[model samples]
Structure formats: C-alpha cells, structure tokens
Target: MSNLTDMEIFARVVSAGSMSAAGREMNLSPAVISKRIRRLEDKLGTRLLQRTTRQIAMTESGLGFYERVVAILASVEEAEAFVSRGSAQARGTLKVAAPTSFGRLHIAPHLGDFLSQNPDLSVSLDLDDGFVDIVGEGYDLAIRIAELSDSSLVARKLAPVHRILVASPAYIAKFGVPASIEDMAENHVCLAAANQDPWRLMGPEGVVTVRTGAPVKTNSSEVVRECLLAGVGIALRSTWDIGPELRDGRLRLILPQYRASKDVGLHAVYPSRRFLPAKVRVFIDYFAGLYGASPYWDTGLETWLGPVEEARAS
Candidate 1:
C-alpha cells in the first residue's frame, strides 16, 4: 500500500510538473512530497528526476518509467472504480478511440448528451484514420466503421453503413450518367484515397471489382469528399458521411443498383464483453440509440438510398 501510494505521488508530481504543484493537489507539503520522491528513488536505486531550482527534468530512465507508470495508474483507477462503485456506477475517465471523420462528424456532436447523462464519467476521445491497439493502448473502447472484425475485441453494431457511388449533379450533367457498370468504369473518373483503390462494390450480379483512373487522388477522406462535392468525380461514400448533401441535392447517388458489401457497418468495439465498465456501456448504448436501425443520417433518404438491410455485429 505504501509502494502504491508512493507511485501515485510520483505520477502526480510528474503530471503537475512540480513538487509544489503536486503537493497542492495531493494536500501534502513540499517537504513530504520531496521525502516520498527520495524514498521512491532509493527503492529503485536510480535517479528518476534531475532536481534543480528552476525546473525538474526526467532522466532517460524516468521517461520510460513514467509511460509505464501512467498506464499502471490508469489500471489501478479502473479496478478501484469497478470494485468500489460496482458495474452500475460510472465514475472514471473513459478513454475511447474512433475514426477521424466519423468521430468529428457523428460521435463528437453527441458527446454533450452522453456526458450530461453520466456526469460522473469523463471521456478522452482520440481520433485517427487507422485502427488502434485497444487493449495494449489502454483504451476503454473504439468506434469502427468497417467491413471486418477484430478477433481480440468485442463489438456492438451502432448503425448499418451503406457505401454507394455518388456524384455532384453538375458532374453527372456534364459527363452523363453511366448506363452500366462497365460504362462507368470506362468513361467516368473515380476519386479515391490511399488504400481505397480497386473498388470492391457489391452489385446485383454479385461483386464487381473496378480499377479507378482517378483524376484527384489524395490521402485524406475529407479531400475525397471535397472533390466529390466540387464535381470532380464520382466516389464511393457512406451515407453517414454525405447524407446531408444527398438529401439537400448537393450530391446524387450514382450506380444506385450497386452498393458496399453488407459487411460494412458502424460498430463500437471494446476489449471484452465481461464486466463492461458502466462508462463504456452507457456510451455504447447512447450511440446505439442515437443511430439505431434507422439512423438520423438515413432518415430522409428513402427515395435516394431505398431500403437498408439490418446489420448486426456477431
């Protein structure tokens, strides 16, 4: 228990960036904070920090140890929260990872309501274009928009995703709509980013792979969207992404007969199903309710997108 207390104090000192600040936060005097630091250093038999009048600097060993210590402290907090508060009560920082565009567009907008409901919980939402190491990175959950599943993490479906070909009305007016898939492939310009090549679209005649001759290719999905809206070319996009545009007539669904494979959907993934933290549970449930079988994005798209098939995470 003393060791754990020392570790917590050490972490607090590092975070607060000064012994005086840490002492203030922990309600301990600077003398006590300094003594605890010395005790920790003596037990480890190494200098974790370089002490000086101006500012403290972490040694090379201290930098690595600090990283591990923060993760350990987070784990300790989670365990205590679970044991003391029970699974029904959420009172810890909920670290979450999500895709960049989707998180900003969808999840971020609704965080106010989620946080208001679970006032005891705080959230750390990290958005990136790539998948994260959920368990290894100490994330409480992740939001995925993909066709595949990770064997290690448990996932729940939030909404069905429909990736369909779309183009600005002006572009279709100028180039004329493709009569068939082959016509589109031969004639129209397709827009895609890195790792989004060789379109794997599911059509009435099973799956068809179309190689893209993209005029405007970039690494950002937002760039793809901008180009699509500017009438640059036809690109495949999820309804959640361009739903408003489709509804407002800024974009029109081309190749409406073919769409993304049924495997693609919006999912909330976490490390395990057993003993799901209440913070994680409420966030997932809130999103599931926000975008159930009929998501807000697909509400007024009956004429454009037609009927959507029910998708669930297994």
Candidate 2:
C-alpha cells in the first residue's frame, strides 16, 4: 500500500530515536524522512510521533500503530523469505530477550555457532534483568530462568537449574560452617538481589527459613556473585550460573542436605511450536542436549539414582 512505506519509515524513526539516524540507516535524507512521516500523518489523520530536537517519541496512538506495524512488517518479510528460499533456513532477524547474567555468561558465548550455521539469519539479543513482554514487545523468543506463569505462549523445558546456598571458603572458615539451619541465621550474612529475601530451605523432616541481613544489596546477580566470591556474604544462586566457580572451589556449598527452592527453572519460550523456525528449534534442541540429564542441577541425583536402581535390580 502507499501508506506502508510511510509506516515503515515511522517505525524506523521511532526505533532509531531520531529522524537523522533513521535517515542514515535507510540511506535517505532527514528532510525526506520527515516529509514521508508528515505524509503518513496526513493519510492517517493522527499524530503518531511527537518530534523534538533531541529525540522522537511515539504518541499513544503512534505506539499502538507501531506495534501492529512491526508485527505486519515482520510477517511480510518472513513470508517473502520463505517464498524466496523455499527451505528451513530462516532469513530476516530474530529478536531475543534474556536475563543479563545468563545472557553474558551462557547464551552470548553460544550465539557464535548459531550465527555461523545460519548465514542468512541475524539476531538482536537484549539482556536485561527484568521481566519482558515477548509478544507486546515483538520479541521472537525469551530465555527465562523462572517459574513460568500461565500464558498463551508455548514453552519448552530447557534444563533444570538448582538454587544452591554458597559462600567463599574464607567466609566459612572465619564464621564457621553452620551445621544446622538455625545456626545459618546467626553465622551468615545473607546477600540478596532485587529485594529478594533470605532463601527458605526444605529437607526430609521440615522447613526452615534462614533469616539473614545483607550489608550489600544490588539488583544484579553478577554483582551478587562478585560479592559472594569476595567473601562478603553467603548467597543463594542458580547452579547453572555458578558451575565453574563451584568446580574450581572458589565457593563451597553449605548444609547440602537442605535443598534450596526449586521453583525457578530454565525455559525456552516462544509464541508457538506449530511453525517453529529451524533456527529456534535447533537452538532449543542444542540447549536441551547440552544440559538434559547431566544438568547443573543434577549434582548428586545421578549418583544417587544409579545406586538406587542397581539395588532395586539386585
């Protein structure tokens, strides 16, 4: 349609935050971009963007229009690519969201192989330590490490992540390892992030909530990990996030019998599975293969299960 070009220009301007930047990206002059937007507004009879010297922001109607436009544009491009290629090699771009710590330490490192395998496909990964609306924000996929809520999106269990209590050896040596759950309250400074409270541990017998005060609190898990590694305090973290440190003996587990909360687990969520692109499917499969049975959470489960099965057979 005649107005689709204007809609695309408007979307680009909003994405780039300025007409000049959008112009540069689109290989057009700022004046041309402005004129196109003006024509679009004339056609729609609504002001979509509030233009200023420094930045261009979307109006309420503009925001709504932009959302629809983005989805339509993406679908069109996907259709064109599918028709052109006639194969599973996905073209265009993939927009992904993930937690900051996990993205940096785990997902980012593996992206190279994915990119290399799919030459036509490109990715834009956003790493933020906050909940993101995948559909509303136009994200193709989200790698989440949390207890998934009931949603329309389809989700696949990627791996099990154990939430474990840990502290540096130096801190344990100075404070003395707490043998019982009650002693942890008196001995350990509980380091937490994002206003999270001290973890509650459950064992065979009963439940115990360890009340701990944090001298240093941050919103970043990476910062919390650093503080724990620096002997600042005892902290609870996901096993997938601290496997290397645990293996290297930089941090030691405490009260191994008391299991930390298992509520949060790793998941790969997408809009649907019916038409899952090859790239997304391959990535999910790769992640599952990499951490399925011998996941970071399976610290003692494999060894314990093996003996139990052997004894049952005997």
- What TM-score, over all chains together, does every model reach? 0.73, 0.72
Against the true structure, whose TM-score is highest?
A: 1
Q: List the residue pairs that clash in candidate 2.
A: none
- Give the alpha-carbon lDDT of every model: 0.82, 0.76
Show the colliding residue pairs in model 1.
none
Q: Compose the digit string of candidate 2's lDDT tens values, residues 3-89.
A: 878888988888788999999999999999999999989888999989988898888889778766765666666566677778556
Model 2 TM: 0.72
Candidate 2: residue 136 lDDT (0-100): 58
Q: lDDT for model 2, on a 0 to 1 scale?
A: 0.76
RMSD of 2: 5.4
In terms of TM-score, how similar is model 1 to the real structure?
0.73
